[model samples]
Target: MGGGGTAYLTGYEAAFINPANLAVPDKSTRFSIGIGTAAGFFAPVMSVGSASRQFQAYKNYLDAHQPEATAITASEKQLILDRNYPKGRSRSEHQHRMDLILGGIQWRQGDRAFSLTARTRFSTRTEVGRGWYDETFEDLDSSTSVRDMSLFQQSQFLHEFSFGYGQTFDFVSGLIPRVGKLYIGIAPKFILGGSYLDLQYDARYWFTDEMDQPLFTRSFSYRSTGNFSGATRHYTANGDPSAAVQRHFPSSFQQDFSDYTTPTGMGGGLDFGLVYVLTLGDDLSLAHSGNTQPIEKSLRLGFSVTDLGFVSYNENPRSLDHARDTTLTPFAAASGQKYEGSPGQYLSFFDEVPDLNPFQFNQVGRSDDSPERPFKAVLPTSFNAGMLLQVNRLKLAADLTLGLNDSAFNNTKLIAHFGMEFAPVKPVPIRLGAQVATDSPTLWSLGTGIVMKHWELSAGAQFLSPRGSPALNLSGAAVGGLTFHF
Candidate 1:
């Protein structure tokens, strides 16, 4: 469901999502290849007003007046409470993010496959829990309530390059109604990536511009692993961090974009998958997992793991080396990051290091020595299992995806999806799916593919809906280019 393609992908597309499918093509040309890009944003905050109305209002006002001079009236704010601010109490769970993936490509032939891809992702989340809402939005007071509230946020931008190769093999497995060969594939990948910037902040007090309204952090910490040539210093909320900024880093720190990466390096990754195909009736046909291609297939099962590795940045990137308390504190990954947790546990940016040290005032300040030596940042890993039931032109698939760790450049938590693709017109097909995760599940998703005489084309979103009640809260998309089937 949603973007979970581990089990159902075929041909050229299999190179990335699950290369195991490369060896077993559906009823199509033996060889295939394609490329495309997809980007999206997802957040828990929902809008209370119609997006169309707001867009039209802004268009009309801009046409008649100037945006720099006009302020929304009380009525306008009432019309769209969601756009004006947010709904419900601002909790630490409130998050906002944007991700981009370019040059997503794959090539497949026989039981062999290759994939090349480049990706860029960025995200920021600020959980404004309970009592902090009044302090954050309007009634600026931290003492009005007894609730211990904190507003904290973290953000990151990183890029990746991956080239992979995979091979599929089948073995006799008597698990089915009759003796069958089980298909399994593994892809070893080479990857190169680095972080441009990383940031974290927390609120100690609240106020508006009318007051001193200083934008000072109550308890915050920061570290930069980019190409910043200036002196690297770790800062905590206790001291005047800005003062240390002038003393440590150079003003040119922001001027040079070349030094944005702290620990840039190359690493390796792996993708592994297994598929068991079953023949239904009629002429016995061994079909690809969840595909109708095999002669006659009733059921298919698939299991796969993606992005299972880390990039070791050989250079010692700058890390915040501030002194802190001894209490075991946990830092969370950005909203969409992965981590080791049962149902509720997760690793975040804070988990970037195994140390549970929290930044403290008297303990930490700018330092020349760094604790972070040449280290490896784990890539986001996804473990997924799916099943497909197929008959004729219809195929249904269900997938369960679990994030291995939240420390990767991009991350996600436990999610489930249900999707189906049926060729209403023979080889031409349409797909619909849903994300059934507990946090922000999207109600709908869609995709379509056209099989021409020589090739096939496909595109669609994981799921999307305007911000509002009952709106689809899904994120991500996978649009394809051309898969010239040979």
Candidate 2:
């Protein structure tokens, strides 16, 4: 519910969300074993409609049916001239992330817990720049005045090996317990970098002409880092950046992680969090709470910092930068494989630069330009503050998560989540929640869980316009998991 598990979570979930929860003591079992997964996509759309309608738009993109030149309008050209999100909205987002965890076992005793988990994470973001619009609707512009544009995109896929430990404190000799109890926990993880790519490009032109390519000058800077374990020579030794991408890229999660043997990249990070639970009743003693279920806390406050490390890739990575004014043939395959659009359509950049052109360098193992050296890529660090109020069999929670850096790839949103969990019956519980960001709002959520003795199953989803709200903010994603307490 609203991603709020900072106070008293158990098992492997606490290792990532808030490790402090692992130390809160569990009434379920001393040892737990389970496996779970969560996947979702978010896009700030121009219109708010049903899921089927939004998916239709995506399907149209996959089909690649460009509009005829005569069908273009003046208003559409102006929209393309502006650079920004899906439809030039200054602060918007379109991202897809998935996490699959093969959870093992966790043991808890007294106020300590130890756990082990393996997770494969995949996430990527694309900014709908003006150049992107030009790619899809280049035929609309029948000009020769030389319009300049740029595009940037980056994505990462990795596996994490995490070991966690957590502890709780009632009262210390030096630090008296103003609150009922204090819990602290940490999870140190070893990250294995599977593959990553960052591409940026700039084009100076007006329209598409094929023979001269609409009279344009272009430059591209690309990096294919951290995927050399089972390398293949996709492109020739001539070092043509366009030739390198002649193959189609199928977007899907690769289930086989056995190729992660050779450590092309190595990084270590830890999650640190602490929660203070405040008692409201006279019998809410920290010492006696060990025997009680859920610690009998009325209010809990927590703060956590996560993903605090970077990965250094020393594997053979290909870094290619090329620029030319001469027209080059578009890539094509006999097996019905072709680029979605023009050569520049798939290119995207992270920031605005004056020019992205660089001299081409051969992708040799010993080449100084594309040498086999370690390059550090920072993690998406985040800070979270949350409060949970428990009364009887109901819990009310509010959470605020802030991006440590403005451009951090994940959890970098200034959003607020409000949720409530009610257990009418001891074996079943229901949850409802809502979340909103400054750039977009009206994201509501709903879910439920069933606890049958030693087994637990839950599923949930967050929506942008599930109710067909005229003003849609974000779209796509469903989250669910299954776990056993024995």
Candidate 3:
């Protein structure tokens, strides 16, 4: 429900969101098992109106110039640079995430609960600097220096097996005032790293003369690790870029499935949560007596910290570094060779430069003999706080999530979520939610579900739009799930 389940979710669903809710005494179902999946993609920087327009203009330019044209004209390059890379904006990022809850089970007895879940999460993020894009599209002008231009790409897939436990403590009426019950929970997970990849490229260039016969000094470094180690070897030894692409992005379905199922490392993580349910009306007497009976609560507050750990990959890892300060003439196609205008082709200019050879190095430990040393990647850690309010058959929830770090799966931004659930009838529930974050598009979501005595089914879709855009874009998510409760 629009990422606002931190306080209201219970049973199996709470295992990953906020385990404290598992021990809530008023839960209607004591046991539950479920399976679910979710996926989403977003480009935070591209949500601006100007950026969207520029992207469309760039696409139109590409379509207008087709098979006959191998390189963009100077004017065309200048147009793209002016439209896409405005002043004060130097970087853009795109991120994608997918999650699969293979299976989950939760059981509650009295004021205690236990849960077990198996899940897999995949995330990828790419960040490209303005200078990098300008260089790729052949827009670098004379008498200009591009420093700290970089392209960073990273991805990770992890399989998690978690064991959770939660318990409720009834506080004395006068000791804690209006607080009736306090819930605390923890989930420890054994993480199996399926695959991991981190690649970083940094380039610096100084151009002194005109475009066709310019003299430039350039330096660049490329570093990568994980499953791409073999592919990197192929590219460096045979100069075959397709091998590197094919290793991560298989053309065949069978190869893709095989790659998904492979394991590369192992690690551990933990989630901790706490919730306080306010006592209202006659519930004060029950709290003083430490009764286990269900108390109707009007308000609940929750907090949680998740994904507090790291995974170390021992898979073949490689790092390369190079620096050069020599003047080189502008790139020219060989006799009968066409400039494909591809990213690989543009980057290949560095290879033709004189005295610019890259050498491999160890990234972690300083042992020169062990180039395959293990490298560690941390999970996306975040702190979440939420509030849930209940009145009759309607529920209102609000959540705030603050990412602790900017990893592949997380960003250092504050995301706010608001959601509502109403049950007009006993067996049907309707949900609506919205999310807002700084420098990102807003998202609106709608969901509905069928809730029977023993089973439930749910589905939801999210819509995204820029702050000033007239219509929503097709850049959101769809999620569905099935669960059994007893």
Candidate 4:
């Protein structure tokens, strides 16, 4: 289904492809939103905090200093000594989820045009365990023991907006005879970003009920962790002894986000394009030319680049929490006691022992998992290119897109798309397309659309590929959207 409308040839579905191509903005004002789900091919990785180890370390320090006593309730003790401390959350995304909601208005007044577009996107994820537990406690029910185990999961959303303008001029007499018009355009964009990730998990253990009926306990938990890493020295709780805590974290997570305009200040970029018409007949405007019929329409070619410039972020170093010390209290094993009083007492507690390094992965307890690290934020970039054939009412189109990581770390991905449109009736049409990529499975799609006097509507379905790995594969997607012209 090739050869049809001007929009098909330029592939500017939202006027985002090339602002200049929007010169003759469609009369219909439209809005479009797309939703898709993908499987994360990778297994979910877990992070945890060691409450037991932390308690043991605290106990050792207390024994050495022997501070004033303060009795506490069972609930208080559980809150202070529980081994499972909340350690924020983690997310596992399967693949690219094109979850975007959009609305826009295009204004076409003769050869000049302008458009405004805005969109918001939402995404989700989850993780299941390998099914195993090593930590065990005495069971009360029937003289049996139980281990702690669980399943973990999370979800995110973002918003973006852009405004553009385009102009066109018939210039065949100025340049080549076959060429028709030159187009120029530009757009400014503003993006608002924020997300909420809820990490939920279930831990199964044992606790005796009042009836002494050996009861099993199930705990549903959540954590709220933020990005911070640094070092500090201060008196522990009471004024007993001075202690230092060190926080270890990656740089990516600590970036400051106070300022949020265009990442590179207030600067913007421009987009340019050209549409040429080739005629097969003799020239009508030429020296000693006889009467001739000029060609009205022919083949058309188009090209454009969006966001070709860059936005630089603010340069500010982040503050970090200090890593903690495992042994401030010296142990006197021969005497089965320890001194937490001061450096003098610590020296006395351990008469002779090997010196240790302060900066270590310090294992607080017997558990194998490392302490949960601070979370990180990531931003992305994308590039697009496409072509279209216009022959009366039939329009065929194809496009290529690449997404690149422009953040602290980088990964490259490419996507290919092909589609055709057929318009049997003046305002209604049917469309079909397929997406191909090396990193992703092939996706086949079918769609239909309508262009009314002032509004445009479209609906589509896509069947994703990579036939196997059902748990981590993208099955299919249902997409629909609307656009408006002012």
Candidate 5:
């Protein structure tokens, strides 16, 4: 919900957000399908985008083990809390979680109509630490050197396909005939698959002017003859004093900052309606009444500007390997620069290097590395209204919508929506709705339909705001999508 916006619903899912409202059909050839899943709780706000560099490397390991307390004594703070109490236990991740599944079909002919849909969505997240790194400095100070570090961790996967068509006309047939009905819809979209990943980070350094001594007098002699004391530690040039690290992971790892993502695209639109019928009879007074009638249902409003596509990606996947050189140099002379044990001197860099066998990324010169690219970009628009009422066996229908990217008022946008259907208790058909917006969270929907004659069953629900906060007081906004019909 941080972009590519939308909101203005006609009826359950509103044809994936408006495909000429799928030729406004209550029957004829209407087969809709929908499945929904949602999980929310995202709080990562540091700003400057790119997930604020993984929250500045997770707040620099929580400011080096959560310090900031006073008046010692609880066994001197329980031995400084057992050397940092298991790294001050940390866990509460959910930056962005969402799931979706959709299906559709509609076909009508006399004036012309057609629709088709097949949608699939699966997004991944979980990015915290790792973004290129190679640092070493006893005190090259920039808040304790080791800056300009970049490790690797990010994720993404998507799939899509959609299409629609509609047509209608009646500009007073032949001579002096009634004038009404004029619809026009056109939809086309196709989005392919996905995959993109890049990761690697190495570390190590001894700054205090290339330390010979002074890391708290070599790890805990409590000797503070400083250049920033002697007991400080920071390294990642492939750290391995005796490796073993991994606190927790899995939140889709920050989705690797996008460059492309629009699954597919297409567009076209138009719709208009009018209905009138009424009668009343029974003689009475004055000049004597014989018959009187009045009834009118009108609808003339709709819009569309869909997909409008483009998606392509590749963001510098790092690389640097000099035949895995080993550092060596203890001392040397003659400007060849060296002073302590020399065999190489230390240097390494890798941003997503593994698979020693199965190398991938070809096509610069073309030997077949892997082609077929596009990442993300989208703009789906919609606006609608409908009405019909006949009181023979009892029938009343209603529909209304708004969605120009959910609206902030592009000519009055409250993404207002409504639905109501009733057909006298029997075989079944009872619907209800109320969707209003502005700050968001004001949904109340209910639906049910059964017609076991040919084969029909429908179900729907919309009642959000589970906790509220589509990023600050959308006032109870959660429940999203659920549908079925045949």
Candidate 6:
């Protein structure tokens, strides 16, 4: 619920959050199996300067008017540019994430627990400067001189198999009457790298009035490295395939399933967690058989460090670099041609223009068919800590997550989540949650779950908006899962 599972989750659902919780499953559950999926997007409009206000205006305009228009008017185009583009140098970022739990099983006996899970994760991020947006929509007569304008994108997909174990320690339970038990857990994961892509583009442009046609000089460099066959391809300057370059491109997803199943890389990772539960009244003896008597707890505290490893991609990996400086007439457009197709198709246009000929696409790594020097991509590591409080039929929880590094899946920022759950009836529970981050708008979520003796089902949705402002659900997410326990 709103990414607040660090402390209170149990059974199979705790495999990814805090494995220590697995050892504290329901009193009657000895085994559990589950499947789940989640997807989300975050495109924060920063509240610095007028950019955020303009973005809201632009969104409102689109929502109110634009459902039936075939062609955009000049006034509309100008209005869009004025509203969306920043006044000076600025940047915007967008991120997307998806997770799939193919299957998972958890088994607990006495004070020990074990789990195995198979899952896949995908994430991507894109960042662009204001100059890039202005260049795309501004009129030809608009004189804009921009330096060091840049666009960057990174994406990765991976399948993981994890084995986890947790053990409870009650040696100190009797010393502190208020402390119920302590649990520690560790999970080692085998990761299969499905695909990876990193693209960086930078440009400098200036307009010169020295010539009658207003000479425009532009210099740019483009670099990309990965096995993203669906998005990019390479060819020799003669418009033919080079035998020296290994063409690992797959034609289509419908025709080839191996494109996704094949491993472009391989790596390993580990997760560590610790949890302590505090007793409310009387402390239960650890001598009980099968731990039949449940440990009564008023508060629970959890901590974990996850995804600490790297993947080295060596199988047919490709790296391309291109840089050029050219001078041409202002606002020159190729007749009867529109920008379309993949990156390879768009780059082909440079070869057709006389002023931009001699375009050279250089491969950076080894040229032979043998394995190339590997490129290492690190995992999105993070540290999480949270606390949960239980009171009769009501529960409250709060968590804090700190990203250790910046990547497509994680950012180096602190995020806080707060959640509450109330069980009006024994078999049904209602939940409400909220999230706040350093650089993004606030997120609110509502969810419900049905808990029976042998089966469980849950679903939730998230909405994004600024606090104290008109609610504009610019982004949303939906997640659902099913689990069976015995």
Q: State the C-alpha lDDT per candidate.
A: 0.49, 0.56, 0.62, 0.37, 0.31, 0.61
Task: Flag the better candidate by lDDT, 5 or 6.
Answer: 6
Query: What's the lDDT for candidate 4?
Result: 0.37
Listed in order, each prediction's TM-score against the native is 0.65, 0.71, 0.76, 0.46, 0.24, 0.72
Candidate with the larger lDDT of 1 and 4: 1
After superposition, candidate 4 runs with Cα above 4 Å error: 1-13, 25-93, 122-157, 169-173, 196-300, 307-379, 406-411, 468-486
Cα lDDT tens digits for candidate 1, 1-486? 366666677554454567666555455444444555454444433322444543343232212122222233445333333432344433334333444445555555555556665655555444443332232344445433222234344334456555655554543543445624456776666665544233333433333546433232334454445432122333333233333333433333124333333336667777788877565665354434333243335576788888788766655354544432223223222222211110101112222233322343344435535545555666668888987777887888998888775432234667788999888897678888876653342547788878785666777765444434455434445556665655
Q: Please say which candidate is ahead in lDDT: 2 or 5.
A: 2
Worst 10 residues of 2 by lDDT: 331-340
Error of 1 at 161 (Å): 4.9
Tell me the tens digit of each residue's lDDT in model 3 across 227-328.
456655665666645544454444432343445347777889988899887856555423533244555546889999989998877756665543444455
Clashes of 4: 41
For all the candidates, what are their Cα RMSDs to the real structure? 10.0, 8.0, 7.1, 18.4, 21.5, 8.2
lDDT of 1: 0.49
User: Tens digits of per-residue lDDT for model 4 on 286-400?
Assistant: 2211212222223444455544433222222121122232222221111222112211122222222222211111332123232233234343444555656545556667676
Ranking by lDDT: 3, 6, 2, 1, 4, 5
Clashes of each: 24, 7, 0, 41, 68, 0
Give lDDT: candidate 5, residue 236.
Answer: 27
For TM-score, candidate 2 versus 4, the one ahead is 2
Model 2 TM-score, 2 decimals: 0.71
10 residues in a row with least lDDT, candidate 1: 338-347
